[model samples]
Target: MQDQGLARRELIAAGLAGAAVALPPVALAQSGARAPDAPRSAPAAVRAHRVEVPMPHGGVAAGHPLAAMAGTRMLLQGGSAADAAVAAMAVMNVVEPWASSAAGNGFATCLDRKAGTVHSLAFTGGAPGLFDPAVDPAELDSGHKAVTVPGAFGGWIALARRFGRLPLSRLLEPAIGYARDGHPLDASIAMFIRRQQAVLARYPTSAAIFLPGGQPPAPRALFRNLPLARTLQGLADAEASALQAGADRDKALMAAHAHFYTGPVAQEMTRFSQANGGWLRMADMAAYAPLWEAPVSTGYRGLDVYCSPLTSRTGLELCEQLNIVEGWDLSSIAAGDPQLAHCLIEAIKVAKADIYRHAGDPRIVTVPVDMLLSKAFAAKRRAIIDLARAIAFPRGADIARAGDPSLLALADDRSRGGDTTSLSVVDADGNAIAVTTTVGGGFGTSVVMGDTGLLCNNGLRIGSTAPYDGHPNRAAPGKRALLGNGPVIVLDKGRLKLVCGTPGGETIGQTQFQFLVNVIDRGMPIQEAIEAPRFALQADPSFYKAGAAISVQMESRFAPAITQGLSAMGHRLEMVSPFAIGSIQGVLVDGSGARMGGSDPRRMGYAVGY
Candidate 1:
């Protein structure tokens, strides 16, 4: 055991030491140069790398360079962390439209330095009021029928109004500019466009914008969306007018909100939906509002981990998984040891079992979130794991009864195409925000509203269409779908420590779980924690098709001995590419107020601090 432990430690040390030298050519190509005619001030350092940027005042980590720079620009402009986050998200909508957009939905967790409290914002859009369960499943999965009311625009304006120091117009300018003047397309987005070419080609407007000349844009090619720019400009103008019209901030915010949900924007959206045989209506748009609530938290060692509550099941499941593993001496186990991986995977399976059965929109389902997160409950669940072998979990009713030992499995359901994006920011004042946003797959529904330049979300596809059978997450009208994105903030002794999250369909929770374990249990630096090879348990059937075994998918970077050990223990293991797992972006704030930012090497992400 000691020898194996030593080998794992040495391997990790070597990997971390070689990270900078091992910079992938693809990442370098994306971040190292600019087009000949591009502006000199445009970002040229947005690639995924292993180095963490340390800053005295603020830090920003985003999925793209231009977006990260937008956040940093806000911080430098005397905006709070919330303000920077809003700015970054708006820019993401413009630059990474394949992953997120102004017409998507999102969830955010913010740590207010002055208030000394953590808050959550749930802006996940729900199924349209007229949604029919009898609709063809294939149609409901894509096309106009899959569209839902978008809440991202309202969510951004709300965050800026409540916690930001800047006006909505100012916060949105960066995105508006990017949309109007054009920005260079990165390698990742270019690939997404190519992959979703057939889907985009079906929607003329979408094809006109994304598939220019009936082809995907080349990497670093200049791309502009004048219609999107005009739409953003209209919002900015309305926001500015609202701010000037009222002495009360709340009333001013209400006016701004009305402009999107109850005014011309709403009319345009509803008209488009109705004209296309979709279900969205003005009532659905006007009835929508982002909810502000307390975050769900669980203590791990001495740190308090907070995550989005309710609509997002990521936080609840993550806390449960952490609690189950907290009883183990994780540090004593070597970094890449099979035993450690087994324990973590087993805990993940247990947490996911409960997540599938109980997680849902709180307004519609009575999810026993508190009970599921209780330490006592975790202890009971942990006792079921056997260190010597892998255990297959029971399905449906057997899961509800914790004592059931029978193992019956169902075929896994393969996850379809959909992408999400994430960003993390920390300002000089110590305020922090972690945001996960998505339009539900690349270019969502491929339906761009006429002249609005808004691509509506296929959020309706997120809900399970299988028989409800009393399941908490069953498909329902006006109910938010179960989402994988969970942004997190960790605090130690009431002081902010880390803000992190990722954009990987079902891999979101698992990635965040491993990140926390890497930082808290293994004592790795933020960048090392993020860049470390990750392992995910493919226990959830939602992402795999029938006949797939409950297996562990790990980065090929692990030591051969570790893989052999897992196989010997009767565990099914599959090796994947080093960058196939998750694109996580994070910021770590130390006791002295210094901030360190890290971006995952899996995708084209950038971390900037100053």
Candidate 2:
């Protein structure tokens, strides 16, 4: 027993020594500045639970530690940013099933370090071909009818074919392992599960997987999803078989795509939906294809900001907000200054008004993209902002006169809840990817596919349910939803500067915009930029029930003086939790080839580097 005790002590000593050695120089210096017996790592965790990792070779920041590590593993295997992103996303689907899933949809921005070009991949879910527009909005918001034709699998295959160096099977191995062997449920996930117990209980399959004993799992409990693992393994096996059958890279990818969208998987999904009275069909699955397009870009100061175009209204909204704020010298404004917050809030209101008025699926509507992105248009909209007073743009005002009021109201009433995940990665070769994914509402209809363990998305809930004639966003066959996802890449002089994104539904664009200002204008580090208190404008009337008043939601961490100042400026103020806004993950790679990764302390996210 004495020998065993001595060995345990030795092991602990060795671990401490290893941790000390692995500490960054800055961390070591800070440790030295404190008392010798004082805990160095403990205080760091208590203060912010994050550090700006300077990755000389590669880095990844994701919503969960396991997901980030999976991406790092891919980078270590000499994979491109695209490969790492796919690996991370797959792991996220298993670990963060409450927020995202393989059955969900997403958007990605990949930056080619060599070519200095940014590409936008739009895998946003679309309505099934036989979608029932007359269904109750409440029904579409949850349950089987809410499921759209998933695009994430096809998206992964496409990204791999375009830029990955490793096989799709290898990229997905980490996620498959985690799902099979089980991972310890973290505090964040545990809390989410507990909160969602009632909702999850409505579906037997979901309850069986998430609540094994009719209760939420405690933190650190081992959680496994063998069915999900098998599903992923089957996909990997299919991809391998296609490659071995003399299929070229693209052909192999297409074969794998066919396996998911046009083969047995599609048949199973169609059968399940039909049995459950859902809307998905074999034709919808076969017709689905993820779109790849050049990212919409606008110059902000000296840096060029790029975002997903068309179906995602966030890009134009972000550009217009930035343009309006560009005329002001935000650098001179203090970080928590109320006037600065007011300006940002007002700018968002103006931008959202334009988004509601015009933004939609480009295939079905003339989005007037150029006009909305124009500096002249921004200036005209900027003139309408009453900085001293809060403004509430009535919902459906522009479309009301153009369409049936009842239909317009139904379409405008659809608002997405903030339930999504994000990741940002930068490889050794300077390639980067920023990705945002969601399953629509949290827990995503709370229904799991029988035996498959796939939690289908309720993405259709975010789409316009009203069948208004000529309305761009009205529910239609094969129409992509108007998503708020805004994965971003920032470039300066044709060189990559930053890759960042967040998952906050309506708050996605606003949070990203604030991050840019904090970093570029305030000269803060990536970690500091994310940790800073933020204000969100709840001015869009469409986001609330009828007669709900517009107000500004501010983090309690902001100075009372600032809140008071905003109140004096005629803005309604509502104090919220310190970390209640968006959880942003990002990486900044500078000209010197130094990459720093940042993860939000608001959630159980982490950043890893080498």
Candidate 3:
């Protein structure tokens, strides 16, 4: 393909020295078989600017500013990465409720630097096990199902208890202070409140807090959560007591768990779920447990990547998608080549073919993980792509064993709303945590718990039903819901290289895929890579108002001629904004060993590294 020296030099410059970044052996061997097609382009350079911060022997925190600042504060206080992440998550619960809340769940993948092991913590909650699936779908959409056994609290506590150097009480102080005394609302929050005021007004509890006097608060209005502060303090007290367990060990731990799900707040949640047709039980709250397991993974250019387990399908799908593409030349595809997009999209389609058919909760479905990520299977999957024609099918070819009924159901999620939030923290000890949390939509279920300062999640409603076929994400009792929030960690040469994740319903996977390609293939910095205009392709029709939402910039360039061409080849298309396509955040270590990072500029995001 090219002189070895030049390739080696480029790899070294890109920080891939002494690394076995094995491309698909076939792709490498076929480099000289034929010249690749040229990429589509606009006359003007599409400016994808990014803000990169550098920290020397310090830390970097990203997502919301208040959350980032809180994490930084923790790091400065000599807390571990886990401590900082727990603090940041708490603040995000208070300030960025549009994205997530303590009432929902989260999954974090952390690296124990000293042990050189990757540990994954899934805080994702499940439906009350004893609940009946035959409950009215409408009621299930209401207040009762809203009360999940909040896994975020337990998950955070577990992380801190396992890896933190600071006391939980100290780690929680920043969020508690913000919630108690109040903090000025940022412009983004204010604007969102004004725009969604009518929608928010539907929920009395939310309307009272988010919209005072039945109107959205003015910009910079002080937002306070006295109840949340009390809840946080109660948790702090519980953690402090539990950490010092003794003769009354079980008693204190039980008290800590009780105060939220089964204590005074329990009545409010129980009443709401019963009225709303939810199936939550006091027993569900007390018995729910967060799972700690090794993350699902695959290698990319010598990097050992880790993602959440199959409780949710994101991790398996991630590996499957990458496996299919590993046999293709990503660099040729990303270096301004339309064929690259076509090929990558095709490969993704093939991987998803298997994902929809088999990927799901391992306890419920028997998935062929080995077959999906195998290089040989990838070659078989890749053979389906035709560079000249789009493979128009209901879904990709099934590369693995198929299950009986499709699990995904098309619930009326338009009402539940979906917005995802994510955070990343790297400590002085080199342990890193990347957590992606969501409430399944903005102000999930639009039903706030009375005076609890908690918004219930409609995670159950995410599953698909009959008319939509037996999709892998259908609603069911005790089944973990499908998620587009894929938090991931990448290790290079046994050292952590990147910790990152993103939001955007189903677009999360496509966004992560493109961002990874931007960095590892196009030679872009982490920020520029993530900020680049992105696109996605899922076999599902739901994501599209009318087919896929293509970028306006791309629309203007392609016109009817290109559309007709792709359409003739079978790709349905719609127009959308480039920025709205997806947003991502991540941290990377440069060849010089400097830790640099970036957040999406299109969002109200800030990345700080000292």
Candidate 4:
């Protein structure tokens, strides 16, 4: 205990207080060794009643600790995993607004222990049936493109009905109270709003809700959103009514759902989108529904990895990159062998080639599944990597390919923003859920809604502008836009090992790949994986733009020898700060009824388990 206290103080003095505070729960026993006057009940023993997991390694859990505590509180209170996740999402909307909101859609994957099955939910907005692609570019970039029907509500309900043990109303209780009673401004939240103060001021309703005093809320100041509270309460009541036996139950739900799409919500949104030259219609909202689909998966060291299949190529590309490296003993590479870096960079490029070519909505592209993952193909692909030089351009292996035909954007676009939030949870019943939600880039086009007190997503602008230019992630209406959010789950011998994901636009997969390697391959703790320096081979469209100058501008930490070696073999080395390469949040459940949670240092997030 004396040593632990001394270490904690050292961390605070070093300004790594968050990391110190988020120490893994399992470590408490070691850290809390007793003193002569100390109580016999150890810290871990006392916490055993709730199994409060801690983030191992180091870092402060960003955001309001209360929100995550409330989620874990629900789990301790006998709520289902889905219920806890929903509670977490609602709380995050208040505490982590730069990352997620009720107005944005979310993706989730869950393992149903009782049913012995895995289910996927795509709470993503779709293109209106009547959307036309020929609209003016400027108009599309402004308001028209940002007006997708928010699909998060439908997504939450779907998961609740299928896997939740508690009623949806119960899940929403904490969020409603916070919205009504008010919350203190958090540092991260205040910083995000202040950064976007000029943009928030553009939307009357957003400004009115978030900046009533014509300024961003100061950290620790009390703030409230009564309208948002009413909306949440109304939804909760409607959910309760739906489960009740009354004609008004159906009517109430219908009204609430309709309000956002074609009813009152639509009326206000339509005015803004139209005024901004957007093409969204009230009908788009009325017709939206979150899709449930089979997840894309691959085996890594016998772990069955599952990911949302359609639209995003993150999962597929990840497998391809891994396949290229699986043939070699990474231990040889990690020993500071220059050849190791060269080979890994080469494998990344090969995998990226496949992403630029065939990864897209399964509805549109025939993803070359078998060929991409074959060991033989991976070996052959690995051969393309030179031991001494980087490949300046991406090249496909001996496999079939496709291209991204949806809307896409380059990083140079002044409109570009890349920030996201991830959340995960599990209940006492052994049900687990992982979710990643975003508004496409930070603050999402910097637009906020009027009546809803919500921030609309600019997800529509995530891909290549030239839809059929052979780019794998071009944007299109009715197509899932090229998303950076990749929520994932890993199972070992049919049991859950890890539930994780990240938010980093093109850097998402790259970060996740390294994090997983650190945990499964290098045996590093989750906190170490998240805080470690990382790198990525930008996907198609991105490399063509950022590739040339990145190596030149990068710092020396990457090693000129490494960059030169990779460049000699065929990689474009882009220097990036080790600041979250991607923000990751997740929970790790061990067999002894012990739960460990971790949040990435790069982003403001928290993981609470009880």
Q: What's the distance in Å from true for residue 379, model 3?
A: 2.2
Task: Give the alpha-carbon lDDT of every model.
Answer: 0.79, 0.79, 0.67, 0.62
Listing every candidate in turn, what is its Cα RMSD in Å to the true structure after a full C-alpha superposition?
Answer: 7.9, 6.7, 9.2, 6.8
- Cα-based TM-score, every candidate: 0.88, 0.89, 0.83, 0.81
430-510 in candidate 2: lDDT tens per residue? 889999988877877788876667877676674332234455676677787777788999998988889999988778889
Backbone clashes (count) for model 4: 38
Model 3 steric clash total: 28
Best by TM-score: 2
Provide the clashing-pair count of each candidate structure.
Answer: 4, 0, 28, 38
Regions more than 4 Å wrong, model 2: 1-49, 394-416, 462-470, 539-548
lDDT of 3 by residue, 1-610 (tens): 4422223223333332223454433431213323232121111233345446665645655568888888888889898888888888889888877777777877888889899999888877776775556655565444555445567777776787678777777878988999899998878778877876776787787787788788887777898877778877887787566667652534454455566666756666666656656566666666666778888888876678888776655677777677777777777643444565666566656655566556555656566777766777777777777877776432434544555553234332332335777877787778888888877666666666767777766666533221133545455567666555668888888887888887766666677877777777666777667666665664333331122222212323333555555556656666565466555767887776667767886566667766
